[model samples]
Target: MDKHIWEEFVELERNPKQIERCEKNAEYRSMQTIRHTLGRCSYSNKQYKLDEESNVKVVPKATTDKWLMGHQRPDGSVHPSAIEAHKKVLEAKEKNKGKGLSSDDHLVSPELEEVFPCKRKDIIRGYSSTMSKKQCEMAAVASAALQNRDTDHEERMQAIESTMGIVVGKMASFQTLLGMLGGKVDSVIQMMIANAAAQGPISTPSPEKGSTTYPAGVHSRVMETEDSAPCTLDVGQPVQLLDNVGKVVALGSIVAGVTVHGRKVKPNERKVYIEQVYDQKALVWDAPQGDGYVVLSQLSLPTWLIWAEDRLVGLLNS
Candidate 1:
């Protein structure tokens, strides 16, 4: 399924020229468009440069990076910071499942690592089977709330099994997304090559049509590579994707290399465009009774558009 989705994405990028034009439009030159084209936070590298005062390489550490082998919560959500810890814990769990724990297993599941007041380590040690069973029963009770097609209690049991299968399938899909992450890097690298090609020969001085030639000792500047550089994304690498916290809505491919028709302020400052990658608003929870609602136009992040390669843009959910 991952391969199928990625292949479809790749097919979309076959025409880079068209994508370039879309990316360069004035409406698309907004911060929102740039974010989508790069498929990550629109300003992470910008912020880094502001603080450091150095030329920072803007890498596309977007959704693909997050989807890979990162630390996933029990509910199957990945947090950028917790990815490493999650990976270690998941490794331990996989290693020790059904098999007795060994001393080496301690590396992944460290002793006394507690996020909640309760001892998660003790739970893994089987010292809290009663609590575990209680939790499972609670989950079963909660699962009953899910709308299922099955009406009969017996049929509902089958529905629960089917739902669990779906959850497992989604987890598998996230894993597969990570494996296919390498192509993003390839696309960026190829774009750089294309940029190099765009830099053609410099014109020499002609006698009648041009000015006089300089002396032989005069220094001549040699033509180098293009100003734009490419940064590739790695699989399973967790980078903060959005300037603001908002769910990803839509994704599309872009072709905003130097030769493409993107808005170029200077030679290097070209912006990419992302279409349909945001919700009408950002979703958040507030107090009083703690209700969750979408605040329209309050979304801080722009939609995700893959500017160079087959990038996936997060779109507004409207």
Candidate 2:
């Protein structure tokens, strides 16, 4: 019997007009009771009702009238909350009216006036020559204050840019030094290997099985090689996706499976490969496309790659 009822429901759902008619009927039935007693707030258009306890409560559209008050015409008054807020504002103004000008109302300081050089004629022309003394004073003060604020803001911005320039210069110098050292070391190693080969089949000692040497140069070489190689993504490799870091969870012939920003990849979506990785958390590339697909050749090395390489070099050197 349940199966029969479910089949009937499925049939009804498959017919768009039938489904829409049923929805309309259901909505009408739901609103029938509410249309009888409750009302809507004139200000908010939200439904309200006077419960049996004689207190007003917000309710759904199916349980309220068109207006909160029972009267045919709305008085255009504010909501209770707005009324209370207005009252508070008026009270505050009344309390502060007798107080003298506060700090914010004061004219610009003497030192700032010298820097800003307010023109009395400009202020008078800004409004009118017959302007009150207080009005003229306020205008001059405001103009001076605006000028001071703009000047301060520009100085602060210049200082920040100068500081950033210094930091960037230092970083570039450090990177240049590292590159020179790496090139020298690589040349020395290559020369030693060449000389060893010239001496006739001498066996060279290799680093331990799990140990690595000169990881910074090695990483650079690996990245170069990978850039030219075919895309080889596998499950569990960390990928920088468009919005978040995610691990490759599945592989497909045409599409590679990946979770993006912690969201599971849905079936039938095209997967685009960014790159292969040894570490699951390597920040090597910018995030892939938001839909998990991207043009492979268009990607560039991420900004974090240099920092990662430096860190690896530090660890290897230590």
Candidate 3:
């Protein structure tokens, strides 16, 4: 956090509400300092009943940080999900293999932003007295515009997870969705596959694009390359689909290819296609909106739309 902001956090004297807030802010700052400076949480000093062997940092459930989700620790941090939290919650995963341990029990680091949530650029913009009326209004409007989008994202992700189950299960609904459009999206899918096949093996999720776009909860079934860490796009910002988007497009292409081939897509075939998809460079651009989303440039069937699995999906009709 900036020095000025830290000072402001220290000096907020108003009514009961303001005083209460100031106390919380000070506590948050103290926690952050201990976590970073000591390389562990203050709570980690004591022995817990759960894991007596290893003393690990524990993020307690506090009313103050209820809204704090794991976005910042995402840089090389283990995902909270059972699948990705490869590091065992206990001593080590390998030591207790086949114990049927549940996912949530794993010990993961608490997400700590370099700045406190109140001190973040977006949230602070509204609270800052220095901002003009127009700036605050614009910020509010942007927030309002995000509501429907956030809802859609949550719904789509839920549906996607339910459909894909565990790892890569048969997306029968996506297959059915494929048939509903008939031949509408075949060309696009075909072109994407041909391009990927042409390029052969390449790195996935190039760093210039910063950290993985996948949220903490998601089990990123998509392949990740050795050196390619996705860009750290801020929350609610436009997704950068132009970069490292081949794998998502490839998922759609393989399913669509089954429709063209007149046979049920096999599981092994799906795995092969998915693994190879990330090895090639992606050609993920050229939408009229210029946001790198997958929207059909042509208007063959106005009623239906082509949607990419992991990336942004835009609708175009002309």
Candidate 4:
């Protein structure tokens, strides 16, 4: 019996197809071996043979369980499911052994490091294990390049923020300086007007006829048809004597005995009037007041102001 079993095993080893089948499907190989052993059984000097015409013959239910028991491990234990799983894993390994990294492997190539910097060390190690020295060097170069790019990006952002802060500070300081100069100019203009009035209508040279030209020192100029026409101030127009701008809420002649009001005004200390009603006399101007009436002539719009109302509106809408 031992000699017969050894002969069968030798025959199976010689047959390359049977060996392949055994590796691919161990349960089928075991069943084939049992069927071959059963074919060799003799009763009354006659061999008891199974049907050789059919590749898939139905075995007795009792014998099926014994044949399908699967191979035993070194510990002399059999688990068909675990065996099948292990066979599948080995098959997968053999299929991918000689070939390069598969898409499912998710191996980080040197080129991919630029875009996908976060690569698992386990994956990297697996890839590197099979790589040549040149390939490893390339991967190292790619990693260094990615790190340098990140560092440069961080540095560039920091530089941009610092530059922006400096620019903003300078702009604020420039605006403050302009406001101070504007206040001084307003005082000088008031003093000049007062001196001119005291000189009793001294003949001042008239500007060119039909010319819409403005003086160089003035920020804005608006020509009116009549000198006595009530000057209209618009919202967001900066007052010449005040530090901040004003918005016009209402328009009308001030009624007699009706006191004008302001944020920084003292009781009966300030007054507002139009040239047509106030006998062409100007009043003393004060600074740092909020939301008050002012003649249009006393307002000045800067020719080169940044972050203007129109720009702000467009930016907000965009």
User: Each candidate's lDDT (Cα)?
Assistant: 0.35, 0.36, 0.34, 0.34
TM-score, structure 3 vs. true: 0.15
Per-residue lDDT of model 2, residues 1-318, tens digit only: 576998888888899999898888777455332122113333222212122222534221210111122211123343452254334433543444456422234333222222224564443111122232233233233333334456669999999999999999999999999887997889999999897677543221332212223322232232211112123333333332321222221111223444544545444332333343344443323335443424333334221111111111111111
* Deviating ranges (above 4 Å) for candidate 2: 1-128, 185-318
Q: Which candidate, 3 or 4, would have the higher TM-score against the true structure?
A: 4
TM-score (C-alpha) between model 2 and the true structure: 0.21
Runs of candidate 1 exceeding 4 Å displacement: 1-88, 97-133, 140-318
Colliding residue pairs in candidate 2: 38-64, 38-65, 39-65, 40-67, 40-68, 241-287, 241-288
Best by TM-score: 2
Residue 21 Cα positional deviation in candidate 1, in Å, after optimal superposition: 63
Question: Can you give the lDDT of residue 258 in candidate 1?
Answer: 40
Cα shift from native, residue 57, model 1 (Å): 50
TM per candidate comes to 0.13, 0.21, 0.15, 0.20
Cα deviation at 161, candidate 3, in Å, is 1.8
Q: Please provide, for model 4 over 200-256, each residue's C-alpha lDDT reduced to its tens digit, 9 standing for 90 to 100.
A: 422213343222223332212221222321233233332122112221211122222
Residue-wise C-alpha lDDT for candidate 3, range 219-283, written one tens digit per residue: 14443434332432222222212233333433212223332123333322221112112223444
Lowest lDDT block of 10, candidate 3: 63-72
Q: Model 2, poorest ten-residue lDDT window? A: 306-315
RMSD of each: 37.5, 27.3, 32.2, 29.1
User: Model 1 — which ten-residue stretch has the worst lDDT?
Assistant: 284-293
